[model samples]
Target: MAHWFHRNPLKATAPVSFNYYGVAGSPAANKICNDLRTTRARLLDMFTDITCTPEVMKNATDAYFSLLQSFIVSPDGSTQDNKMRFIQNFKWTDTLQGNAPRHVAQQDMVFELVSMAFNVALWYTKFASRLAGKENITEPEAKDVHRSLKVAAGIFMNLKEMHIPRLITPAEKGRDLEPRVMDTYIIQCQAEAQEVTIARAIELKHKATLIAALAYETANFYQKADHTLNTLEPECSSKWRKYLQLKQHFYMAYAYCYHGQTLLAGDKCGEAIRSLQEAEKCYARAESLCKEYRQTKGPGSTAKPSEQLFFIKLGGLIKNTLEKCQRENGFIYFHKVPAEPPTLELKASYGLAEPVPFELPSLSEQCTPEVYATFDLTRGAKNDKAKPKEEEVKPVKEPDLKPQKDTGCSIS
Candidate 1:
């Protein structure tokens, strides 16, 4: 643990000690001093446990030396002053003056330190693995770990900044305040955070199918709204139609891309390439339609900023899919074929004079007898006109027939 701390000095500080400057004899001062002592004790205990391992000792020593060097080169006060100056220059007086709340800042600092430690550990681990002749971790695996850490950090940061009690108001002694009290900002932020958390969780769990389904549902809802607006307001039909088309295409493309990625994972390169190509085409069409819609709206028209962001996101997805395909040596070519005109052929008998003029039948008269008899039977008859003689028929003998009697019941 000390080795870890030494490698990352930021991690050495207790969470509560961040920005805990206290006046003498103040409660804050006491709290900070106690926290510092506890942190030191924990580090000392961890250091003692690794005393038998020389390699661990050397790592710890290096970490300590690096941290000491950092302190000697640039002290904490100097770093704080620089940060203060930067924030002040940006007119972030509230943050500088401690009015932004210590917990939020501390949480952010803690997350930053943890992030740094993770990266350092990752580098060290990779080096060690290489020396040990172990299989190397893949880029995607590394990315997944990093993403998980970041998401965890985000959750912690949110927890630190959240003020549940403050956001809720007590009802008056005789009246209900639930209807009147509302923290719209907090509610919106929480809702968005939940969405992000759920999405990230799904990704981490490898429930990509679920994620795709959710995305499809969201897109469909938006498309339905667009359709509803168009139906209710005919004058804005064109705008809504474009909006609906863009959303439908974007979602469908996103779904295709997700499925393509799954195929790529399964080593179906050809199928993946085709799916990704189709997805790219869909996204490109969506972007073009969005641009056209914006242009049609004219200058000074207040268009939603999200429309442009959607295009940007879709473009990024397309580029990523293409890059992935290229990296895997999976590429496909689409060719355009030109249409050829129909050819007509005519056949004539050599013995016959140039075919007699024939009238084309009208649609109603197409199946008439005149059309059916166009090929005269007499023309193909044999050239000989001799008559044949008929033969006389002889009578044949017939056998005699006998009748039989049937018995009947008297009761009938």
Candidate 2:
């Protein structure tokens, strides 16, 4: 049994006591905050279970469903502009300490673990669903995953709504608090949500048009969620630093892989190869970060073996697929190793243990530009005026106007 399991076994199923991080005025705020607290606490309990039986897993899914419900937005939602008001507060403290570190609490770490597990569960559900007629997964396993997805979609939709900070800005905030913190949470949630979406895509790979649609959605979501985790680095502790490093780079790499897949689907071989190469590079860094975390933190606290394996296989698949892309392209390019890996930003800035070079090119480079500049006559004239003049400017000529004689018929 894992050491974590011994902490409290029966409490795993007990209801969590909901406490406020700040004052929530409305019924909607109270319900959402209370529910979020309960959900996080419940997840923390299940994460410690060494024997995560099917029954336990089912319970976890149930709890997730309840929590997930709180985040969902209805077109005629009762909680409009009310639930997020408290969370949008600048002085909102989630812990007892006035200036507590973001990742200090057990629940903070466990919430992230829950997110990872939830995504893995989504994959398993879709995976088992695809092979439903086949012999791999039992009927019960398929049912469990299906249920998990129904709940997970709630979380994914919530993340989607909050993809931009403006989306989460509760109309009741009265005054704008520091939105940076909440934005980080939105980013992390969006990334995990996209990963779950990708897993569904992977399971449906046999359908070409469907695969293309999924590929586009996956690539776009991942592209958006990428690099947003960088905000969590300075404000977090070592544990969060490690988790962020592993997740951020891994998803960035995963996003690139999906993009490569998208390109390959479109028969853009050379572009696909370039994207896959970028994926290869980011995955390598993710691998290194994961290793470093294990070495320093011990293998005690992390997602279960099944969850971890999905990403491991994903990394390997990226490698093999990348090689395949290169071979089929009829060209191979070797990347030159930098003399010393570029200094990790977390090391210098936050003093996080990670030295892995995770900073890389963004994948949003693939998106169609919505706004662009096109210079024409006015812009050219402006540019001409902006040039440094060695001599005085000449006076402009005014248009000539001739006076005309008026008809005298209307003398009155």
Candidate 3:
């Protein structure tokens, strides 16, 4: 008899858990929470329909992209391209109702709109990455990369400097927007946006700008997020901490890859090797934390199927990215060293595999090479043949970091 998945008693998959809830007894917060819950359910349904109804998948994806594109072109997200757009296009500025302004509600939609753009960008970016450097990279994949980058850039430009609406206060009541404290949401959006920006920067050979942006974000988020987490209440605190830590480690790994790549772009092989080693260390930490935080829930608990898949795929992606980075940086190693966090005990998680060996293409050769080939930023060197090379950066040794006891680096 042929053996199936169930036949192999030794093969077991671990469960993952997730939950999100609004502040208890607060109507305003409750409504927003309900809206978010509905949104998550609806999006998952749409995705499922697309999967089952393959005949309409392309049409659905196109419509989805168009909706995303409409918002991308309009940073304010005040325009209404589709009736089904997440944010309702309300036009009642300066009108007052009892105590609050009528338009006050609209101010908060910026976060939601930016979030929508971020998700769409993430989806297409993954699609593009899967197809990248493949033997059969079709027009669809190339188009996905182009559209994804556009969305990512749009999200960054729109939200990079945005402030958190002072609407969400620590107390039950609202307060005036604070100017001093950084907006955690925007910081996160911008951090994710850097993935696309860094790739584009490498393609354009602007190593200085890429390194500067990555370094700034990594440091900024670590300091700010660490401070925010210290002030959180007990309820949902651990959940949110896990969420933020995931992003923090991701940014660290991301920075390491580009830092190494920038060195390689300048022919600093030794430095690039060291930077990649740091990246591997970061990835291992992230992998362990990811599995630990989302470890299997006990019986009778419910989590969305789509959400689970996303987390699983994300775990795989980090491993894949690290493997690619190491190969590209010319690192030769035997076994992939698994770095465990000091806090997490050995635990099982979904979709994490040992980093497989693969050949990564040159930085410029991967995605949309024509984007760089057809463009000239310099005034005098408009001709293709006279294109200037980026100035080679000298190799510099980064001071090795001592093992620190506190690993609670994250943004709110």
Candidate 4:
């Protein structure tokens, strides 16, 4: 199962000191700053250790975001001005922005919100991958994998729709928070979550037609995700796009193979034969792409997708089903094989994955009104202490996001 999913390394970040600028130092304010530093460090450290459970992550994230809310959004929904935003500097490196530790920094708290949320989303993906890679996954573990992916998708979508718009400086192209990368994360998480559902359905002895439809829709999700990165440089995006491409073709093969079985049950031997033929071709193409993916130079940990049981099962199913269809057609019906393959089932009526809704926790108790009132409101003065110079970010070559509509599946 380790080979079932491809994962990029987590984005690196610089530590924050939370030094207050032009403010009278008080216990509450100092406590708040110390809490911010402690909670943020805890949250960031979780990424380095994937074995941390979701409950631990939630508590750490909640503690950090609760304190962070005072800097950006208040408990009562009041918008803070530039004076509050420019008080602290936050820096983070992009995931696909090369091997060096080059980072982009901003004197804006909203930027901090976006970068931290992005990391949290990535942690969910890593958590899901860790769960999925176990030698034997139980029913509860499978459900955990499914839920983690949906939560990850939700966080990415939340960053895109809510926080990204509020950033004082827009995210540059190819950065993790950019719209294209955001869409890629959202789509990929949902698609992988659906993979769990497809596995469950197969185990439950669901109809071949249902499994085929689900597989086809899952393939569409991966294709859409891959297309979002099309405008980026090949060096930055090629490996990831190849991963998506291979998964797309692999699920398509799954669709056609199960579809052939459906057709066989309905006594459409000719159509079944043609469908199985298409399945074989798609599986072969996926196999080639898997090899290319391994050789491609890029970021992220390489996965041997071709060696996974899920992949191996499809090839065996395609071979056995195709043979059965051919043997039955020759001895029983002798129906004419059509020139074109049958159209794949476009949509699955049920079990499609949807992102869960997410919102930051409320302002922490340490950020009281007295502490909020003590901060200086003027932006004319800058922090005299030296800080990391902001890196020059390249303009994005990405298009506007065009997210696919979900089937309104219940994530509960």
Best by lDDT: 4
Ranking by lDDT: 4, 2, 3, 1
Candidate 2 wrong stretches, greater than 4 Å: 1-183, 206-238, 265-267, 295-301, 304-307, 331-412
Mark the 10 consecutive residues where model 4 has the least summed lDDT.
401-410
**Candidate 4, 360-398: lDDT as tens digits:** 987788777778766665532245556546434332222
lDDT scores in order: 0.33, 0.38, 0.35, 0.82
lDDT of 2 by residue, 1-412 (tens): 0110000001111233333323333455445546656655555444434344445655655555444333322223444432212221111112111122121112221233233343323332333222222223343543443344343343333433442233333322211112332333333333333443444545545333333343334333333433443443332323334555666566556556766666666766677677777777877887787666555431113322113445567677788877777776665333332333222111112111111111111212111111011111122222234543332212212112221222111111
TM-score of each: 0.29, 0.38, 0.33, 0.91
Number of colliding residue pairs in each model:
0, 0, 3, 0
Model 4, residue 224: C-alpha shift (Å): 0.7
- Pairs of colliding residues, candidate 2: none
Residue range with the least summed lDDT across 10 consecutive positions in model 1: 1-10
Residue-by-residue lDDT tens digits, candidate 1, 1-412: 0000001011122222222122212453334334433543343233324122324533443433332222112232243311111110000001011112111122232222222232223233222212212123333433333333333233223322432122223222211111111121112122222223323434354454454454455345445545443433233235434555565666656656666666667766556666677778777877776676555431112233233333356567767885776667534433221132111111211111111121111212122223222323234323224322322211111112121121110011
Q: Give the TM-score of candidate 4.
A: 0.91
| Rank order (by TM-score, best first) | 4, 2, 3, 1
Number of the top TM-score candidate: 4
Which is superior by TM-score, 2 or 3?
A: 2
Q: What does candidate 3's lDDT look like per residue over 214-308, in tens digits?
A: 54364355446545544543232343344456556655665665565555566554555565566567666756656654563211111121133
